[model samples]
Target: MLPPRWRLAATSVVVVGALGVAALGWWYADGRAAGPLDSVIDDRLISRGEGYEHLLWPLADLGSPPALVLGMVILVVAAVRTHRRPAIVLAALGPPLASLVTELALKPLVGRTHFGGLSLPSGHATSITAQVTVYLLAFAAVGLPRRALLRRALIVAAPLVVLGVSGAMVSLERHYATDTVAGAMVGASVVCALALALDAWNRARSARAARVPLSGQAGRG
Candidate 1:
């Protein structure tokens, strides 16, 4: 589990990213960056954004219905027979559920226009983020406890790569710089919240169970 301080830092990064995206969007809308230099930057951002856009199709297909169904079937088998519920749940639900909601709901609601889609947040970035997050969760569920250092490194490195690629796409004007930034922010935030909530729920249940045993012992005494 991440220490509280590290979790706070993660939350802060997401909040700042989202704010930066919103500010950039407003700046563009208000014509604050209409000068030649800004236009040049925007052009570059757009060019980079195309790379991200092209990458999206493959990544999105990974989380498509057939893939998800196959994953779930595997997870159910693993969980029911092998007692690997954590691994099963993380693999089957994490990325697909988060990515689908992001693509279908939040992206549409934000309605911040982009080169090819209604873009408040870059779907490509969100897709990449979800992919990394889901993988990280799966690794944590099954592989990380034994090699803590390597696991930690992978967790940190994966998201940064996703962010870097997404940012590159947005910076080159494939998206309004804001769109990619927002996508990264929202994607990370949602996953973090999900993880934290799950942890909390487990902790609470454990605490209750512990109390139950203690109470029974006390009554016997």
Candidate 2:
């Protein structure tokens, strides 16, 4: 597994790339403006009909408001159980912050419409991505073992969850393909950036404390 810093960097790249793709589609393409690749993927997924929709509904529902609340409750419980204050704080604040930025800023700034409203970044996609990312980070901070089967399962499941939600949104015609992509990018980027910032703050605080005692001892000597 990558160190936290490396993971942050990787997620940052994804964020930038995904947002760029979304912008390109919004600004440059014609009506629908999803480009051939996104259009093709959306068409294929939509063609699968009721059977696929049934299969995807539950997974997609994970992105809903009630589901997000449940996820937050689970995160808080886990953080308290593990006594991870930083994790608790991060989990508490991160997703809401991401959602605010996405809804209040990016969505309006992009001004792309789908299903009759601004949809450059799907709000549901943003919620699910941010929620999952923060939860995973909280779990890791609480000392979830790297080799644990649950951890391994989460690693595999995260992308699937994002994809499922994005695919469902597209298949259901709730968002354009680029909207979900941008949402995922924004959500992941915000959480990863927050984790890196918190880690750096803690490291700096520790270093300062370590140096303070040494300096005092030297002065006494």
- The number of the candidate with the highest TM-score is 2
- Once superposed on the true structure, which residue ranges of model 1 sit more than 4 Å away at CA? 1-6, 10-42, 45-91, 135-156, 167-174
The backbone clash count of each candidate, in order, is 12, 0
* TM-scores for the candidates: 0.64, 0.85
Q: Against the true structure, candidate 1 has what lDDT?
A: 0.58
lDDT by residue (tens digit), candidate 2, 64-152: 87887888788777767767566777677778777787889877777777745887677888889988888667675344745688887
| Regions more than 4 Å wrong, model 2 | 1-33, 141-147
Cα error, candidate 1, residue 96 (Å): 2.7
lDDT per model vs. reference: 0.58, 0.74
Where does candidate 1 have its weakest 10-residue lDDT segment?
A: 29-38
